[model samples]
Target: MNGDTAALPPHRPGSTPAGTTDTSHIVQGTPAFRRTAAALFLAGFSTFGLLYTVQPLLPEFSRHFGVSAANSALALSLSTGLLAVSMLIAGLLSDRIGRRRVMVAALLASSVLSLATAMVDDWSTLLVLRTLLGIALSGVPAVGMTYLAEEMDSRALGLAMGLYIGGNAIGGMSGRLIAGIVADHWGWRWGIGVVSLIAVASTLLLWVQLPPSRHFQSRRSGLRELPARWRSLFADPGLPLLFATAFVLMGVFVTLYNYLGYHLMAPPYGLSQTVVGLIFSVYLVGTFSSAWMGQQANRYGRSRVLGICYGLIALGIALLALPWLGCMAAGIALVTFGFFGGHSVASSWVGSRAGAMRADASALYLFAYYLGSSVAGVLGGVFYTHWDWLGVCGFVGVLTVAGAAVAWRLGRRTQPATGELALSR
Candidate 1:
């Protein structure tokens, strides 16, 4: 289930009224399209930028909190862990309320929490605020995907999704880079404060510019109706494997990044924090790869394209195990490129396969995705402490191999023996 499987879901007969006006689809080259795309881009930026603001500050956290690398990682891990669980509920909540309202409130509330996080002196209090930020963020990502799937023209949907993900890549990069550099000059709190202020602007753009949802009709289904839809989503042939891919992919990526700062800061490469921050600019490659690879998947098949990406991820991990700085940078860039490309393809695949349950499918994928980040990210620190970079690489390597195996199985199931071809809508 790939390629033209990216097509939109058909309208339910009794649900949408006659003469409701077919102005729902915001196709390319229209004013509504421009506004909606820009608004979502800002939404993507705010959500990720706020969430990852503390990533590069991990070492500083260890120093200040007097904690081990594993303990310091809790700042990000706990947030992601909570965010993953909240996503399950947030999607269903959006079904009851409207998409636009949930997204706007999520952004605004999360931004405020981020700002508050900068001021807390108590370590426990800081963690509490970070946890809340995760719950607040749950409203945006899954709902945003559902909103785009509902409102955008089928032909232009791929590009719309790519742009939003590109925004995520840039936001993640900028947050890490800016925080590291600023922290080196001033303090970690100041670094976090700056990123929060930027997120405030991003929130305003999403609130003011996003066109209200014309396509979303409120679903009155309560908690009782969720189990049936959950069963349907899991039973789909393509979706379960895709969710596993999400978990493994994020696990590998976050594990490497979570500990790389520590490795680069110690003995052989005692790089300054600012320089360390500059290295995360590798995310620019991801910004380009996601859009480009998504286009390739549209022409070729997602299954064929995705396996190659998994191979690239493994190759990158191998490079990181080497002892050269240049080699490490190259490895990180490769990993970033492959990660964004595979994520773009796989995430779009979930929407394609879900039919009408776009929000639930997206929520499931993100839930696994963030869960991997929380679990594997913290585990990486333990490996680093015991056996250094080799152990860390070994852990990530195993996950990548498993991801490749799953990708191969998915490809075989989705493609015919005659030739690889796009799935019909």
Candidate 2:
């Protein structure tokens, strides 16, 4: 072989080979990319579908298991609590092992735990299973954001991320709906069994359909690296804001959802669990809002879109204070849409703002995201007990306003913003 033709120049880091079109059908928009998106969508759908499946079945759990309101709600609270704690480790694990493997393992294990939860006879055992499932479920969100950041081209990241989130919106809607309707007809056990079965199938589909990560470069793992990564990201001003935004926004969103079921089930409303559960079908609005808002954020600035979304969230939460069911549903829908749209923008902002330490930054943001869920979520119980739905709305609505205020500050800050924060708006 003649040495006349020289070896190709080393490709630039973060640069794909020139003129190679990303034609994957599994991604977003493109046919090739659609399949990829679908796989992750299912992964998103199933993880959340199974994760929050028990939320609407709380009333049935109370009656069957002989527990109180807060205890019945423990099924979801315990899972989110454990999920928040596991995310830190899951992100680090993905950085070392690759996103696909970690995500696949997490989904499958969570599905198995859901199956176990379905069979448990004791309420204590059920909580333990939910917590275990939550721990297993951490693999998805911790790694999914990192995967999107690295795998998708910068030009395509927002749309791709939105589609993955669309999957989440639908999953959250369908999970509660199915659990409530089925539990109403048959029983809570059947409800759990059905969702768990779907999760098992979805796990297989995620593993089989999602492509292996070609862009990921596994990192060197160590405890020292964790602190170093944490410090490095914290040193970046943009990251701390992103992390805090995740915490506050998520806390507010979960708190509203955590107690909404209780409010609808009580005196004034006195709605059947199935009817109340169907209200969560409004989460479909999030699917539409996320995709459209993401596209607009890509065109405009993410910070700008995010502030508007948060404002909408505040307005919606305030409106829910009204007595009419129609107004309440509308308000919930607005808040749901705003939450998804804002999350889509902010979460992507974290990836764009962090520069080369993207995975670490994403993980930290999610760590805050889950911690908010676990902490504010349980604390929300106090508000519920003392003040009822009005109290819950006030607490959550204020957090939304605070989140918007932070985003406003981040949006207005001056230049010389180091790293990806300075990337083209």
Candidate 3:
């Protein structure tokens, strides 16, 4: 059972009144806002920490399981792929069952699955567990932003979203670092096991820290009505571009990292597995940029900041093509900064534009986001095999250019959308 204390009245399915948004919104720095932020921070941490713990272990998997580089990437790409698809259903379930229940269950269940994954010996069984873990992970990301948008004060939403994304950056970095270091010493199984244990602690923290949803009102859009919400989300003039942006950004980001480990491990640099993992600690840059640039977007304009971030991403990709390892590390740092910053702006922008359709819009963005990870991640290996790092950079550079184009066009026409709270207030 969800440990909620009934902070808000329970609205029955199909019983949301037209003016349901008239409820209170949690402003930043208040106790409720603090609790909400802390809860979501832990949620973001655990979800991504568990999801990406295996990334640094891909090389080990290839050695032990006797798989190709591309096949090894499937361990991660498959989870993200299934997560992309399952997010839609999970969002709908949250709309019916309540955000707390879906997210809490997602955290606990996925944590357990991650632990179980460490015990599996067979590659096929490992793949199966990862796949299920993806499905189990769906409920949180699908619903967390929606919950924030629905409950947080409109003026403070951007910063709250930024902090959430910041948690993701740290969690992702810690998982990769810890796993890589531990795997180098103890083996991949123990690496994964350690991450799973951290996830368990994070889950418990989330259960206790996240206060019940104070502004949530149930909207039971049954399975039959799901298409209409999808239609509504796609019909928004700007949302489609934002979805494409998610696709481009995530594709370029994942593709760069997917092969970089191999490149570093094999190159003139000849870094150890532990040092290679330490490079991922550059994600600390992302942790800063996501929060800082989010507030910048809020203060200036999301589109304006987003367009600049796209340019930064391209610039970063270009730098990676250089011969020196120092250049490559710097490039990765820039790319991490840009990717997380742009993600923060775009994600919060989607939530702001979604109105009552926040969950559906978020799901669509994530669907495209992880879909890019799955598709481009594997495809990048082909580029690496044929043309080397230059080929990978060129491919991602093209995607980054496309993203910049979308952002430029989007910034030209769309204004910041004031949320439902503004109308109700």
Candidate 4:
């Protein structure tokens, strides 16, 4: 019934190979499901919490490292780009190994790297360690989705995924906020260490709480299958559009935050790091919005909800032009809400659409998503230079419109996604 496709496969999550007791789980909306989802939410919180903690520290980085916008961006961009690449491997390994183990180890290892990055004395050393951390962080983002598809009931998958993405919203916002606040008071290093400890705690919780995968199969993976899987995914007509949407949406979102901090910190606004950090508390709304949107998508369908979300995004961008500080903050909140909602819906839909290749499909979507972060995160620096905040808004606004248009097309496109329309060459 999803996407109005009658030919849609049974929405049920397939179990692991027959009689695989270690992975057998029932998603009967029980207390167990809530606990599992909570464990996964913490996993997401840890994953993104570790991944984006450095964002608020950018100004301090500039002072300590004496780098320009683009160069300083290397700290974050390198992490996301490396994380993006690592997803491909994580996908392959999860298919061959198991989702729970891969995710657990990924969380643990990344926490170590994050702690290491915090201790580094020089920017060069920090970037090097952060890139490594980014690579290590890739494990969770890569396998989390396939785990949901394999374990959670299809009926509950949308809401489960929303909570997970909601966790991401909270982590991302709080990570940046904490880094900014802690760095303002203690130091950036302490901020990073604090979040790393949080991640360690979350990893342990995930290890004890997450049920083993019941629906996944350890398919023999060779280097050969990777390219073939990529080929198969790209062959889908719907996938290319999905990938493009991922790229544009993520690109615009990262770009906005990357420069917006600098804008608020500079003359005219002259906000302190702590105040700027409070801006990140706006992420709470995103957390709420993502979960709400997911429930709405389940109730009304993704297409309509996606359109509304994107429209809100465009409106949010326009709000940035306002002169008042309150309006600017509200603008940011709207954008945050819109992006998370759109992301949750799009990411969940990929699992449903791919049918069999959920890991690879998730990998591809994440690949686009993080690459957009790296590319646009740096590119927005140019806009930040010329027209200041307004210029940057103009730059991201175009991308938002393009993304919205694509979302509109995706909602209305009824060209049967089965048979010949399965994939595009």
Candidate 5:
């Protein structure tokens, strides 16, 4: 057996070994922890890079395919909608097979599909490929979260989750920037091709670098038991709220970015595709905020940090409503910072609260997350079409306010005995 898996004695599924609790986890500062973080970071990068490569190209698609903004957005919405549904199946599959295997397969397969997407010319065919890409990519996020919660030391789990999400931030920005810039010089096809190629490289590196699962125990429970497990997760005091937060946070964030290019590319600004894509550089703030707010959550409390994130998001929206271009830029940066930080806090909270049902819980949280992305992203386009930028801002503001209320309610709840940080007073 490998040294990683050799340290722990065997135990029944869903139960910890009597005395190996601390030793079973990958502690911070150890080689295994570093390997796991590196692999997951690459996984996050590849997964999101492939998933969102088309975002910056939506206007291009609209012009080429002779579709409206909302129709062009189907390129992203279809993928996210299917991804939301597919993650549940991926979660169950991971429990039966293994988290590492599922994530590796997903990254490789999604990369290949992205390469295929770059070759397609027809509009419907492109949507079909994007939808399939969503399904293919579903294996990474939920399973990755489950793997972290199961294997990482409780004290270090927040930071691990944050790092993984930080990778997501960078991947998303790089994908958009590369695609936008390359599309200006060559075409959208070449842009997607380049991003797909990068995804393949990241996937290959992750395969070699990721250590095998050390703490995962295979569950024999099949789909028949899924309902009961999900019921239990929903019955928990905090899990449902965390899931709602995921939905609102992702929805608001995606809606803002989905329409931003359209807004800036229009009459007054007349920004080029490359310049609009460069604006996504604001996502760099997300890379910082995800890791930083997660550590803050570990110290100050998840709910308090989460609430502050929502406040920042609201402030950003207010700034975005201003007609000034610099205010809009600053607004985008603040929103990016808040959304990533909140997601980190909420996701880590789900893991801590779910206990034995972490896999299902993670899947549910992401399902809501992407579902929001699909639904609200499309709706924002409708608002933009009718009323322009203010309409979109108003729409996102409503969602942000609702999310803040959920965070406040969560703050008032008593922490469970599961070693989660207490809610800040």
Candidate 6:
């Protein structure tokens, strides 16, 4: 058996070859493939939906809790910060246990926590629940990517990852829209409660539909091996750049949305919470862009498509700087498009490049990804507090430009000659 065969699960009666290089992988147009896709889609949906539900309510939290805008953002920042730290451990845990088991437990626990968050009256208690929610959510994203990398056909990986991320887009939009609209009629707590209930439904669907992993090979090494695994990933020229791209892309995207509601609610715009939430409906554009651009990456090149996405993001930021609301709306749509597309390309690239280290590489990538969300997101609030919207814009602009530079550098790197470890260059 070759390296590819060795990486796959032990063959049983009637099993196909393992790994994306052969027909054994879950390919498109098959029932198994469809089930896996649907399962992962729900995973992305529930995880992101639960993570971002508190975002649109930041302003509402400020009013109810009698805190500042920056302080209110802790509800999100705390979750993401803890999430970033927890994913490193979660990845290793899944290696010891099983991917599906970890993800299922995570979804159930997080949904329960979100429901509890809806009932909390104290600000500190709410923050505590959100923090634990982050730890619960850590099981999904990294492990899901590793699952796709292990089980899906390599040729179809981009599209599969895109669909999963498309689910994330819809979840994010729906969560914000639901929370904002319901909060208008009832209260922020009601908005959260409704979202929590929806998450429970999604969790049940995922539990029933997702097939057991057929290609997974459990690792015996524990945290003692983590440092070496991470070092190998960073030593790769392209992987580190891809990780950096994840950081900036997520940070800039979160920062823009974090304060957008506050900006529209104040002064000349003075839009209601419902109207501000409606603005997030723009995330629908992300659903399309992620799949479309993922296909584009498969056809053209991952790096090339990623650079275009960064350019679009920078241009959107420029449009947002204008005082006109129409321009700002268009800018939001463009930013949404760019962000989802860039994320799809970057994440798929990491999977394709990581080879045997898929789990560790994905975990580290997301660690940076959410770390950016935690750090830059809160920092953007500081900019808003000081120089208002322009300050926020400037801060995000710098991050975008820096991310674009990294994408450019990665595009110039040469693909490795080894077939099993080759990247789309």
- Computed on alpha carbons, the lDDT of every model, listed in order, comes to 0.85, 0.80, 0.86, 0.81, 0.90, 0.89
**TM-score, cand. 3 vs. native:** 0.94
Q: 42, model 4: CA deviation in Å?
A: 0.8
Alpha carbon lDDT of residue 412, candidate 5? Answer: 86
Expressed as tens digits, the lDDT of each residue in 1-425 for candidate 2 is: 12111234422235545788543212446654776788878988998899889888876787889987667767887888788778888877887777888888899888888988888889999999999998999999868887777666666788888988899999988888888888878888888888888888988888777766655666777666688778988887567877888899878887788788888888977988889878889989999988899888877777788888988888899789898888888899889989899888888887877767787788788888878877777778788888988989988877887898888777766233443444323
Candidate 6: stretches off by over 4 Å: 1-23, 414-417, 420-423
Judge candidate 5 against the unseen true structure and give its global Cα lDDT, from 0 to 1.
0.90
TM-score for all models, in order of appearance: 0.93, 0.92, 0.94, 0.91, 0.96, 0.94
Candidate achieving the largest lDDT: 5
Please tell me which predicted candidate would have the highest TM-score against the true structure. Answer: 5
* lDDT-based ranking: 5, 6, 3, 1, 4, 2
**TM-score for model 5?**
0.96
lDDT score, candidate 5, position 241: 89
TM-score of 2: 0.92
Q: Candidate 5 regions off by >4 Å? A: 1-7, 11-21, 421-425
**Which regions in candidate 2 have their CA more than 4 angstroms from the true location?**
1-29, 414-425
lDDT (tens digit, per residue) of candidate 4 on 63-132: 8889887778888999999999989888887777678878888999999999998888888899999899
Task: Give per-residue lDDT, candidate 3, residue 281.
Answer: 97
lDDT of 3 by residue, 1-425 (tens): 25333556754323447866534667788888888888898999888899999888887888999988888998999999999999989988887778888898999999999999999889999999999999999999968888888777777788899989998998999999999999889989989999999999988888888877765666677778878768877777789999999999999999998888888888587888899889889999988999899888866778889988998898888889988887888899999999999999999888878876778899999999989988999898788878887899999998999999999888776655654232110
Per-candidate clashes, comma-separated: 0, 15, 0, 8, 0, 0
